[model samples]
Target chain A: MKRLKPSLVFIFLVMPCSLLVAFTYYPAIKSLFSSFWNQGTSRRPSKFVGLENYQTLLADDVLAQILWNNALYALVTIPISIGLSIGMALLVNSKIKGTSLMRLSFFLPTMLPMIAVANIWLFFYAPGIGLISQIMQYFGFEPINFLGDASTSLWSMIVVAIWKESGLFMIFYLAALQAVPANLKEAAKIEGASGIQVFFDVVLPLLKPTTIFVAVNALINSFRLIDHVIVMTEGGPNNSSALLLYYIYEVTFAYRDFAYGSALTVFLVALLGLMALFQFKILDKKAHYQ
Target chain B: MKSTINRIAYSTLAISLATVWGFPFIYSLWAAFHEEKYSANFTWNAPLTLENFATVWAAAPFSLYFTNTVILTLIILASNLILCTLVAYAFARYKFPGAGLLFSFIMVQLLITPDILIVENYNTLAKIGLIDTIFGITLPYLTSAFGIFLLRQTFKTVPISLDEAAQVEGANTWRVLWDVYVPLAKPTYLAYALVSISFQWNNFLWPLIVTNSPEVRPITVGLSIFATVESGVEWALVNAATLLSTAPLVILFLIFQRRFVANFMRAGIK
Candidate 1:
């Protein structure tokens, strides 16, 4: 009976995971395999064309541009988002009245669905009477084409992304900040550490683990920058803001090229895998206190 | 005197920053409550009206979408809580073979999220004839590595003596789990539940890809149609529609604001 009970529990636990493998991991592997094949139609048999999809992807100028845009988007957004989040966290974590309300306000954007947020932000980016353009005009500057022109489109998307994500990351940093021993800060203060000095010398060092955690989370989210692209740009303005996931989505759905989309997926998965490996390695290190 | 100045400066900076962060939301609420045509105007002087909310509510099957979203989120949450707890218990307590390997495999799912695997996941759904269904949307999220890892960490903190005593009193593993571990891990469960619900509720991409028609489309997806490319450039109406779609969650967050923040903090800590 004892043996039977343990086995039942094991089976119950393992069943869902097995389903995960069959449904998720199986498709993941199949996707990688399918990338090498020309799965042309629903009825016709797919031909095995080894590395052809990859070769095609490499030589394709649009694909290259899309990849570059995605990389640039990640580079610009991740650091800015993390930096703003840290700043927000510091402010909200301070001994100020109405700190809770401030924190809540900051996080409000993140709580809304991305599509909803995008819709509102899109309105703000509108030309004639848009909030941003009106503000620019108020400041005696011409209304800059935020999401319209190719030159400014990707950066505009990055700005919107930073706005949405920084607050969410701030919550993580705030939680980590709360865990910091209050005595440490007090001791630093007694030692005549200036506010900035205390922040850099004491608080920043203590938040290293949090920095890593936030950075990794931001990295993963950076790759998942498809929804905003879909809702706002749709990879428009001459494919300037086309991110990887969005590019893959376009290839699969819009362009109807499943094999190439699968190839992009494989590449994206590989990048994410590398990121996960790096994150795990960093997390494995003993968290430094001093 | 210097400290007082510093405090005031920090407070000013914080409030301004909060305002900048929150202004769009205010704009959204205003737009949602204003006339549909007035949604385009960026003025703060627009008269407030609930007519836009009525239009958004009556335009399509938003109630159905909300019900679907709630149902899908709940199912995913319930399944995650149960399966993750069980798996976490095994990892926490048992000396089973291949346990480490199994746990690591589960962790891999975190790296390869639904957004990344949407294409293959869609194909998988098509193969299993679960396309355009709520089950399709929920299946990929059913076994979350974050939930498993969190519950495992929480379960490990429970005292072993409690489990042993329960076992000695003729209580089975399930009984012990229910009687001791579940009660002890309530906070963790609450934390995980909040995270899970928020994630599933705000989730857009997977649901967008899996479910085809309005019948199975979640609110997020339904909200997307209103913001579609063909829609007229009515910013106010779009923002109004957006606000209406997200109102339930916003209200819930406001009501349980403290608990929600605490839950997020707890989840992050773990």
Candidate 2:
């Protein structure tokens, strides 16, 4: 292979690298820099306040609530969605009748925009005359407001996240499941393992890497994806369903508080950086097998 | 007898789960097709009408939103393809100083996406006078780290012999890439394109932050605005609008159902 000239390589790299620097790296560094400052208005010019924003972040009650809400959201949604996806993958991969139809039903939600999904689910969680309410009425029960009530709003968001995400993860699991050596399962069966035992013992362990992959993706998504909260509840009923990103959105865009928003963004970047660390560690391990 | 019973039970479980998974979309369809009165009232004889759809289409600039979304998605997709291809080829074939460090910087973007950097990005766009335009909406996403990564992996897999063989025929670098590398990475391109389209099409927050005009708003942001009116609830009209926004991708998924699944799998496992 011929070595390309340095100038040509520079030309090739300039556009994308410049854009990446302009958008991703520059914004990141700016956020970190601005987090040390305080928000300023025309009446009061901006002031340098080192560690003040972070100090306020430590004391901010709303930030605490938002962090707690996000943690719970991730904790609940990640495990349930992972479990459901594995089940869905196994189901679709099985020799079941109407598997194609089943797969379509499972995966179609993954194709829709999160905003559209939020819209459809908004109706389902509506106080009365909604589907769930109508079903509750049929069963001789009073309708409960899902998104309106603070207690259930976060949980409702969790359900939507699970529904929207599990199908996509199921595709990953399906790919992994298909790649699971057939002879391993056969050998397990030959050792008198039952179907459940074979799955638990042989298949599930092999899925550990996929599980970690999905978990990291889910963690990032739980931080990044707050469209449903914006659409359905708008983090309302006292900010019950507010995740970290939604809070940042509210602080930056809605409230027009840039410094605090920058602080929040820095915090979020740090949190996601941890997840990135975990992923690279796993990727390093996976690379050895290759 | 036990095996038969188990099969029946398993099928029932699978079918029931599918129903639960599909119920929300199915309900939206039902609401879209029915009158407002019949939206929540499931009846065997309820008349289906396109009236809600008509109202929805006339109510908002949905057609314009749809056009903007398509344009935005295509611009980003094309830009990602061309720019990432150039960058990925360099990374895959060339050994430049600081290449490893630069690649790691790109990988940082996979987790801390532009979505999370909204405030600063919005500030930057405002300073550049690109806010509220479709171009502003398309600017940050014109290239993506994942696309670069995927294409680089694909380009690296093309045998060096093929590059040498093409070069021996007096093919230039661009020609070698265009003819030899690009064609061979068709699957990667398709996978990247599909993933990029769906992502940019569905991207809401940044566009919502950047573009406030109907002419520039993508369907997701438009749909959010249309649905969030604090007035009396009109399930039929709202759902009609929802379906309208999602109809294109839904139809595409239906037509290329298997391909969508395969591409998603390929992209995800990467």
Candidate 3:
């Protein structure tokens, strides 16, 4: 064991600890405590109205709609992106000509800023002048307002999320696919297994950890990444596309309702905490060394 | 014959999907270069012109935004490198009290990133008189938990023998870390640096909340404000500005495609 020196420890720990405490730990704890109080200003400093903020949270109709929107976003985006990423990995991993070009195209979106991507897609979803609408007009279909309609607004947001996300996740799946043992597939083939059979029975099971990793990370991402929403929809057409984090942003900044915003933040944190719990329990169970 | 047909079908599907994936960016490139009438026109023979770029350049303070982004990104990257290196060295080499607990606290940050605490962080920055300043934007990101974690894992992989050898050769702790650990973790440093640069450069929400003016706004916030507030501006001009904002990174990506992809893959595995 290395000898521990007091000065060395102090020198190293000072900056990291202070910053983490100031930004992450303190604010997180403060938000939890602040959730129990009512909003106040200098004239009448805040009062501890126990559970009142949470009570308001319970009755919040916008919160209900936001949660439903986020849930649908997570459920739909997660699985489809995962499946698409797997397919993308398989395509690139194959010996197809122009695989390098395909790989470049697949990963290009991962490099661009999500805000820029939103701006680019915004043109595509613009009413009659948009690309999709122009094509629809050529085919004689009526031009649909993709982002303006309440019914299709969230789905449009989902399409952008899937497009931006699946590319990055494809890299993860590609790495995992490359690590699958070649001889194992050969052995399976020797046992009369078809390519699809070998993949489902052999290769895919080995990729479970990667899938779980991508899934949990994608779930955390679903809540945090609302840049597109801000740029494209602003959770508009009557809060039809508002997400949990976006709602917290609006409540805290747009409305200046700190108490209620604190409650909403706590709810978001708890949802993330649930994801953490799922990650640990599930990852622990699934991690087995051969 | 059956296998040839299968191969042709799969290749066609792959190429078509790639086109869809690449279409938005390609369209942005097309619109940014051509006239407005051809944004969705798909005219192969349309005369290309730099008029939109000229208009966009005159419209916004994109040059200043570009400079601010460079300054902000460099400062954050430098600070993260220094601070995380020191902290990671300590965690990797020292046997100290509460080290495990402290390390776990840092790990907690990987999930509860500074991004999610935007409201509270804004309040904190405001109370401390950092709001509307570039320093305020830089403060929350100065020491990345992921950076420390990645470097710690990398430093730990540096065989203890090399560390001991460096110390025995009259190297001080700083010298030992610089000469032994840091050199050995060069790839991790490069990977972390690239990831951090892209992330800080592209970061929007927190910076958007903190910065209120053109003097301190990064490229992303500037682009967002430009795109949203200038609703009446033609798509061609907006797309031109968008392309301008993303040009540096995109150019670097095209030039260093292999290294960028490899580093991203390396970062992802951890």
DockQ (C-alpha based) per candidate is 0.58, 0.71, 0.65
- Which structure is stronger by DockQ: 1 or 3? 3
Candidate 1 lDDT, tens digit per residue, B195-241?
A: 78888898988888887888999988888886673235455557767
Off by over 4 Å in 1: A1-6, A42-44, A286-290, B36-45, B229-233, B267-270
Task: List the global CA lDDT of all models.
Answer: 0.81, 0.88, 0.87
What are the candidates' interface root-mean-square deviations? 3.1, 1.8, 2.0
Candidate 3 is graded, for docking, as medium
Candidate 3 chain A: 10-residue stretch with minimal lDDT: A281-290
B153-187, model 3: which lDDT tens digit per residue? Answer: 77887899988888789999889888888888887
Q: Write the per-residue lDDT of candidate 2 for residues B1-270, one digit (tens) a residue.
A: 987888898999999999999999899999999999988889978998999888888888888999999999998999999999998898899877888898888878888888899989999999999999999999888879998888888788899999999989999989999999999988888878878888888999999999867788888887888887721458898899988888888787678677766765664464
Question: Chain A of model 3, TM-score against the native?
Answer: 0.96
TM-score result, candidate 1: 0.95
TM-score of 2: 0.97
Fnat, one value per model: 0.64, 0.78, 0.67
Per-residue lDDT tens digits of candidate 2, residues A221-285? 99999999998888978999999999999999889899999999999999888867776775647
As a whole number from 0 to 100, the lDDT of residue A273 in candidate 2 is 89
Candidate 1: global Cα-lDDT? 0.81
Docking class of 2: medium
* C-alpha lDDT of residue A14 in model 2: 82
